[model samples]
Every structure is written in structure tokens, then in C-alpha cells.
Target: MAKDHGPTVKDDKLYEDLLRDGASKGKAARIANAKAAGTLDHRSSELEDRSKADLLKEAREIGVAGRSKMDKAALVKAIRMG
Candidate 1:
């Protein structure tokens, strides 16, 4: 059975699964909440389909440093690795 993670954890089973999958606490919580709310997007756009500007914007949003110096391919790699 999944251990109780307090009220902040909306979905205990999802949280436990995420934890077992090596997800950080915050990431697990966000995913669990999103799943519970039916807002979790399982599908993502292909990296090649995204524009350089869009990749850069996402990198910036995710706090990827030196994104200004990276090209589209580099941004894609960094975003994936991040």
C-alpha cells in the first residue's frame, strides 16, 4: 500500500508510482494533481516540430541557463535532458 503523503498529496497511488519512478517530490505532486484534475497532457509535441523561438521560450521557462546562446537542436537536447 502507498503511504499517506498528507493532504497536499491529492493522489496517493499516483504519488507513490511517481516516487518509485524517481520523480522528485514537487514533480510528483504536480503530476499527481494534474492527473487528478484531468489536466495532465500525456501527448507532447515532437522536438523537431517546435520552432527555435518556441524551444528557447520553453528553456527559459524551465530555467535552462545560457539558452540565448543555444541553437534549436541544442535547446531541444537541453530541454530533454532537463
Candidate 2:
């Protein structure tokens, strides 16, 4: 059977915060906040110039592991981080 790895320290805390507010948030929100706070790899400013397709290609080139599954916005985020 596959193992169930629990949430990381950071994710756990963020989830808790969402719960406290009675607003269930998705992974994107957590990722965005982390990025904004300079904790995640990508900064919002860096992705401004690229088109979505270009961003996805760049993300793949930069070795974002799940590039195939990522959408344009997510690709932008990952590329910036990478």
C-alpha cells in the first residue's frame, strides 16, 4: 500500500488557519501566500513578462517535477520558483 505522508509543519499550520476562519482554502492559496511571503521559490514579479505557454515551457526546462500536470498559472508560479 502507498504510504500516507501527513502534512508538513508549514502546511499543517496553514490548514489550521483556514479552518479557524471557516473558509476552506485550496493548495493554491497556501502556495500563493508562501510565495508572497518569500518562503516558496517563486516570486510574483518574476512571472510578469512570460506568456502562459512560454511559462510552461520554461517551467519544464527549469525542472519543475510536475510540469506536465500544471496549468498556466501554476506553471508561471513554478517557473518563477525554479
Candidate 3:
């Protein structure tokens, strides 16, 4: 059984699995929480169609730095990479 990582971690099992698969701490937590919330998405291709403001919002949500100066393409890349 998976041990609880704390209240901040909504899906402990998924978190551990992601860790085992070499995901970064922040990345694992984000994925685990999103999975628990049923918001985890694998739609990288659709990012291109999103506006820069939308991508920047997502970047802010994921704690991406240097977002304000990033162009649309850069924002999309940053958001996708997050």
C-alpha cells in the first residue's frame, strides 16, 4: 500500500509511481493531484491553438519563471513542458 505523503498530495500511489518513473518532485505532485482531480491531460498538440494569455496562465499555475517576456511559442513550450 502507498503511504500518505500528506494532505497536499491527493494521490499517493500515483505520486510514488511517478517518482519511481523519475519524475521531478513538483512534476509528480502536479500530475498526482491532477489525476486525483480528473484534470490530467495529454494534449500537447492542442497547446498550439491556445492563446498566449492562456498559456501564460497555465505557466503561472505551474510556477514557471520568465513567463512575462516569453513569446506565444515560448509560452506554449513552457506550459507543455510543465
For candidate 3, what is the TM-score? Answer: 0.66
Tens digit of lDDT per residue, candidate 2, span 1-21?
Answer: 322225432455555554566
Q: What is the TM-score of each candidate against the true structure?
A: 0.57, 0.38, 0.66
Model 2 scores a C-alpha lDDT of 0.57
Mind giving the per-residue lDDT tens digits that candidate 3 earns over 3-82? 99999999999999989988887888998999899987655548888777778877888999999999999988776566
Best by lDDT: 3
Q: At residue 63, what lDDT does model 2 achieve?
A: 60
TM-score of 1: 0.57
Query: lDDT (CA) for every model shown?
Result: 0.80, 0.57, 0.86
Candidate 3 — which residues are off by over 4 angstroms? Answer: 45-54, 72-82
Sum up the clashes in candidate 3: 0
Q: What is the C-alpha RMSD of each candidate to the true structure, in Å?
A: 3.5, 9.3, 2.9
From the highest lDDT down, the ranking of the candidates is 3, 1, 2
Per-residue lDDT tens digits for candidate 1, residues 2-80, read: 7888989889899899889887776678778778889765445697787888788767756789999998889998876
Clashes in model 2: which pairs?
A: 41-81, 42-81
Number of colliding residue pairs in each model: 0, 2, 0
Error of 3 at 44 (Å): 2.9
